[model samples]
Target: MTTTPKHDERIATMTFASVYPHYVTKVEKKGRTKAELHQVIRWLTGFDDVRLQELIIENVTFKTFFEQATINPNAHLIKGVICGYRIEDIETPLTKEVRYLDKLVDELAKGRKMEKILRSTS
Candidate 1:
């Protein structure tokens, strides 16, 4: 497997709350705003600002976080590598979803435009 079972398991159990601060820090350090970060996340997960804050407070694991999400239809448009794994090539569904989120945040931190990152057809 390109990713170890152990590694996958760890990500599944990891709390979305735990990694949220890091995501914020990464984007902020790049001069991006948390609202933009939240926008990216909302585009992917369909969680509005209010629900997202609730999820953070609930400390849900990635598995639960995704289970409750209404993933955007355009999510298939999120294609690229993140953390050394190609998003399109990842076989596991959950892992692919996680990578999709990671890839978006990376794009934001790299200064990709919101429309492009959101896969808008304009």
Candidate 2:
């Protein structure tokens, strides 16, 4: 059976290497857990665990925008220190907060590197 993480054991990404093993990238914060890293892996590669293994056999260069965002354990059921990354959860107007996140995801999907994306924000 697929036993889930304990309420306190939600995962997160602390380093880019945890997800992007091939990129030799680094995040300013600490690295995330195996499971936390997996979400980004799946999101970046566009492949589930099963499909990922299959693709690995073909030797492909898959990339994902490795980032760490806070997870609200009580709300989305994904809680962690990473929650600090969500501006909406921390401040007012969650709707606006999500719009920004959506835009970020879109930019990331379009091959925009995280460093470049962050530079624009600052």
After superposition, the stretches of candidate 1 with alpha carbons farther than 4 Å from their true spots are: none
Model 1: clashing residue pairs? none
Best by TM-score: 1
lDDT of 1 by residue, 37-98 (tens): 99999999999999999999999999999999988889999987789998888887888899
- Candidate 1 lDDT at 56 equals 97
Clashing pairs counted in every model: 0, 11
Model 2 has how many clashing residue pairs?
11
Q: What is the C-alpha lDDT of each candidate?
A: 0.93, 0.34
Tens digits of per-residue lDDT, candidate 2, 1-122, equal 22123311222212222334422122212332334334444543244666545444544321122122232222332212232344334332232223243333434444556444333334
